[model samples]
Target chain A: MPDKFRGNLLALAVMVCLYERPMHPYEIVLTLRQRHKEESVRLNYGSLYAVIASLLKRGLVAVVGVERQGRLPERTVYCLTDSGKEEVHQWMADLISTPTREYPSLAVALTFLPVLSPDEALRLLKERALSLETRLVQGQASLQWVQRHGLPRLLWIEAEFLLRLTEAELQYVRELIGEIEAGTLEGTDFWKALHESQELSLGIILSEKAQYPEETGIRAGGQGTAPRKRTRHG
Target chain B: MPDKFRGNLLALAVMVCLYERPMHPYEIVLTLRQRHKEESVRLNYGSLYAVIASLLKRGLVAVVGVERQGRLPERTVYCLTDSGKEEVHQWMADLISTPTREYPSLAVALTFLPVLSPDEALRLLKERALSLETRLVQGQASLQWVQRHGLPRLLWIEAEFLLRLTEAELQYVRELIGEIEAGTLEGTDFWKALHESQELSLGIILSEKAQYPEETGIRAGGQGTAPRKRTRHG
Candidate 1:
């Protein structure tokens, strides 16, 4: 099997590869594809150029050298900057770090619970469904492209994997609408959560305890300090 | 339990809140704490500023309206732009369509088979461990600060949850090193597959492969192609 980087991780992978030897962009692409393992990392010039520019801007990488073949286009090669090297070093040190976040949309959606009406939340859910549908269309298109392009076996994995996740959300949303319609779930934490999400402010979030006095009070509906003491740790 | 935004979805939470009301940085912070349930979203200035700025730059959000809020201490209220509203709409729609990726650093790290020499790979792993350690340390510090400041219900779930994840990764990395040394685990594909990582460029990888074609042939390790028409699609 081969190594892979996903999304932003591509930057780090590029850093890792550059650490070994300076590489031209075309060389970089060809090298990645030849490994057969890096199909996802395999990028067109637009994406690659964008990343390279971003890396230079971030001071994580630089143009170490460039080369031109007799009749071929001039090639610009890139390498890790000291900062880039340090970043890679730091990232390696953090390899054992835990998987912290859940998902982008879900994480963000929960925050604005307070301000939005229940109807609005439902509306948002529906909109997300539409986005997923778009993605599905895109995924299917890519799948066809890959098969037709004579791409190797793994090309479909990402598209398929992403689709599976999308499908799960689609089903969950349908189930959610059902819960809403049936009135089996209502007038509860869901509403409050939305409120709290709406309420997020720097002062309030950092001074969480001070602001959330309502939650701690007997009336706020949660059991008190028992859970609190434990998180106070070394 | 509140109908927690499924997976602590932060982006949706923030976007929705902003759509309903444009809050100055500090106000947004205050709300998240006050509104937290057993589990809730956490947003700090750095991240908050970044997202808001990005949104504003992209025209997804506008300073459509602002509040004076007494300028001895300056503050600008943020309201979503019309486009921002559309974006939030689309964001929700997308969420409904996709599956969320979990924390998979170790898995992602493993994707770059043979890209890094054993030493370089080990170095990369160490960096990851360190980065996790730093975040854990920062999160704990924040947790303590919030606890002392008297937050509501001390909504500690997020910091604690993140801490545990980081701890898990540290342990996973140690085990990974052992597996590598034992030679019981070899092949880039295994790491790539497990991690759902992106692939490396074939140029550098192919050169390495060509060095030892006997070990890798037409099927060529984990490149995007199906191995022997293996029918991997689900």
Candidate 2:
């Protein structure tokens, strides 16, 4: 409920593995890799031990046993304490059931895209379309590989999600390129005019800076006074 | 081209705005908000200035003019340097055209799911399904709002992407729940067995630690064993 343990994927992973069975640190590493979980959860042995030590400090796990197998180093196994079990369960519940904000870079780029010249924007978008198409093909092949290996669909749902997302993005980008080519994009005129006017305005400002050097003291750009005029809010 | 300036959304937004024309810091803030670009890019005035100062330092943007408007603080206008224009265009090109690795938290969550009990996992998946459905409805309403406001589909493609993703996730979770209920999931049996055996093994480990404290000196687990077992590669 405190949500303090959020986003610590390594801790989540260690707890998850310990919940399955008490494991020595070495066994935990071996098991995670054997199951291909290393792809999702980082599997640094040093970090794994640190997490275990923290878990012990928190009383989330306790030393269960030690094994001396044919001169191998003493392997101290760990198992989840009652609190550890509860922690992992609640953490997973929070992660799965909640829809938190994710800031995708592509989303951000698209939001500010009107800055580019339409022709340039179109050419770039076509490039994007081609890239997305290539990715879709790669994703499809990867999905096929997963399927061929006979991994559970549930286990590889992430791949499926990604493939579907790539497909959707490819379709959307293609449609957008078509709209730009047909001159049907809603903001095209505004975007183009914004670029043209800004270029001219820059010329004026550059000359002004040259004429009055004292007025243009560079303190910082973002610290500006609020406009006295009420600007429309989104 | 080295993809150095990729994913800095604030810098991208600032550069994009300056690309249109020279703008004082306050004007940039106002225009970003007015255009609803704030929804995607963070609009913190302090960070905006920091980005601007960095841009100036890097010679990406230059001071064009200074304005003293009606008792307001002296406002320094900024315009993209020739290099700034090229940087923004190339950054956008990389962002749109390259499919960079995005590590979504949900993908990570799915990877370690075997730790949860089947019933508990099913319950959580159902909860997620419900949340996704709620989000889908809200996303639909937001899309309708954007459509009614007459914003271009191109501008609001992110909303569309989000909606589509939500729908896809809902469908996947529901299907996953069905697989769990029907006992048709590929790894459910293995997961259940792992949990049962691990719980039993922990009982033994706890008792062993009690009986033989000497063997388990436990100077924090994992400071044990050979320095050289070649760990398999991921």
Candidate 3:
């Protein structure tokens, strides 16, 4: 993998475009947009030009020709050099064959689940499950639309991968919610106890703050002190 | 939900820690490490201090006291302000319920999988399957170790979430590899033909560059011109 192209999918996309044939930066962007590659790769005119310049510097791509259409400025056509072709293959191989550690935001939230009351956590998980279900339906519809139109699956395999991930996550979250609802989730009692104790202390603090609002910075609608009456579940 | 704390999980983590009790920056780091929260949260002394300073500036946390042990400088103990407590709950809820679009590198690679030949893609997918399997095994073993030690499920639920995601990806990759190997992957023939035509053209270009190495900037080991003989599979 080329060091210059690391973590820059736009660069890879540009090289892939050039590998098909020589194209100006604008043409590359248009082709990518036409193919809807932007769904996976972030694209912008400035970054596209920057990626092209870096590729040119690395000799992964070269100027083949320039095109000027009417009032438009001359756009330099770029073609994939041999090194560029090699780098694309090696980089794709590395990406496909290796599993790098990624910190998903959901994982971070789950790590601190105890911070939220058990009931609140359960409510949030149910909300997430509903959202995931909506997305899965939409994703499936799009995948089917592409297939019905006779578009090759290879073009949208990434969408399929994302759909599968969402499905797994939704299933996990649903099961977690079930466990909490059934009072079977380990440490539910402890989690509830912890929240109850905190609520008791918070009640005391809120009463004191109400007496001396100025000293505690507790202005109306300022300190999120809305009453949070704990609701018990069967 | 605080604008200042958006996408800043460290700030959220700090607030969660202070919710337990007021602690100096060093103690916060120690507690997070002890709980193995670093597995999910990126932790560093520098970043932790920066997050603390930012929280202070935002008034999400306030210095409550200072402590000095021996010759050490006074360490300021910070507590979560009322707004900070409210922010943590809102942030956690938002993160759990909202499914934000994340650009995983694998998705980007899959978008351009056609850049590699069918045989190469298959080989790389098989390699990926092996790596995923190894990780799943290690992840399961650790999760089991935690369970065996009587650790609360709440503490390691994030690890479980990650393991499920890996399992899903591995299953999808294996199915993809199987389809490719069986010659049933959509557009396999087209993909093969595309690569074959490119290989033929590449052969011609390589020979041309080899003849005029100086003109094309093809130096020894500089231009990645290593022969790539097409290997057909059954």
Candidate 4:
């Protein structure tokens, strides 16, 4: 299998559609939309054509037949070759079996979290918790609707997994917020003190300048020479 | 406040480094690496310089001084402007509080799970469960090591969140595998029957061809014309 087909969900979806029966590009689009596979796989006409052309070149799909409907353009139908079928199975297996490294935005955010003031951090986190709660409720309702329509859970299992992930994040975020609010989070004092000292230092600088006007002028003049020295070096 | 900086983790990391104090690019890189931030943020010297340049152009970082050590080239030291500090806080808050949509590969795979045989899916999922378990153990050990070093949890909270997500996914995959094995998955019967019927049809077709060679020849001859007819249309 080519590397392009290995991790390409859109290509995998196209192949899976062909697995059931030969289909033209239009039929494949309709089937994917009807199955709501578009939610997981990015679908666009240009990319679909590009994928089909690539798959054809790779011998994963064969041009089975062409059809015409009155004055319409000829539509080339395609079917998965044996190699394509094998690729689909192997690709799906690899995706399900492997845990690849992914960088979630939230994880990146939390890693540099000390950038925000503690109070502001708490406020933002609370907002996130609320958003997650709303999403959980919406996800639950959507899943229940699908169940009510007699759709099998297997078909919508991705949604279930996503909901579970969201629930876990919400739980973790809530606990973190609690720890911060209770002043028990590790390094909370240091994080808080860092900001406090910044403010204190700023205040001290202002007060000292106000109290010693002539001395401040001499110091400012002396500091001004540093930039001139840098200019000379440049 | 530029959209470019909104979700730019590298830019955020750079700004946060300057928030500490004025530092040249080299010092910023050294600081980020010393704090083990490269694990969460993608860092490359070229992109780091590009991010710094963008931040400088946006007036978020000001060149505070220039430094030269021995024969080394002069390095411009940068510090965050007041606006830069505000942007950092707002960006961090937005990232922490916002629950954006992300497409995980596993979720995409599960959406198309029916593409594989139930047996294969179960086997692959079991492998995933094992991998997740091993990762969980490794992650725990690493976190313990950091804790033993007396590093605050706040510094490594992203790892904690990642571990929690991994645990959630592992639990879900295991349950799915169990349901499939026990024949309790909602569509297990349908899924199994689909593959079985495909195999049965192939067997029947082969047996029919052997038993009625004359009729099979006619069908093959008819199918042979399909390509010719398509060629005419082309």
TM-score versus the correct structure, for each prediction:
0.48, 0.69, 0.77, 0.74
DockQ of each: 0.12, 0.22, 0.24, 0.25
Listing candidates in order, what is each one's chain A TM-score?
0.49, 0.66, 0.76, 0.74
lDDT of 3 by residue, B1-234 (tens): 445458567777788888777889887776665455665676778788889998898888999988887887788999999988888888989899887666677888888887778889988999989888878876776676667766667666887898888899999999999888888877778778877873634221111112111222211111123323322211
Look at candidate 3 and give me any clashing residue pairs. Answer: none
**Count of backbone clashes for each model?**
112, 4, 0, 0
True contacts kept of each: 0.13, 0.41, 0.55, 0.58
Range of the 10 consecutive residues with the lowest summed lDDT in candidate 1 chain A: A225-234
Clashing pairs in 4: none
In model 1, how large is the Cα lDDT of residue A166?
Answer: 49
Candidate 2, residues B1-234, lDDT tens digits: the string is 255544357888888778768888877887665544554565788788888988898898999988886886888989988999889878877677665555556766776566566777888888878777766776676566656756556566655665565676677778878988998877677656756764534222112122121222221111223223324321
DockQ: which candidate is best? 4
Q: Write down the TM-score of model 2's second chain.
A: 0.72
Tens digits of per-residue lDDT, candidate 1, A151-170, equal 43222333343344445555
Once fitted onto the true fold, the runs of candidate 1 whose alpha carbons sit more than 4 angstroms away are A1-11, A19-22, A33-65, A70-72, A78-90, A97-103, A110-234, B1-15, B18-22, B33-74, B78-87, B99-107, B113-183, B186-207, B210-234
Ranking by DockQ: 4, 3, 2, 1
Which candidate leads the pack in TM-score? 3
Model 4 per-residue lDDT tens digits across residues B144-219: 7767766677777887888888889989998998899999888778778767765523221111112111111111
The better candidate by lDDT, 1 or 4, is: 4
Model 3 residue B23 CA deviation (Å) reads 4.0
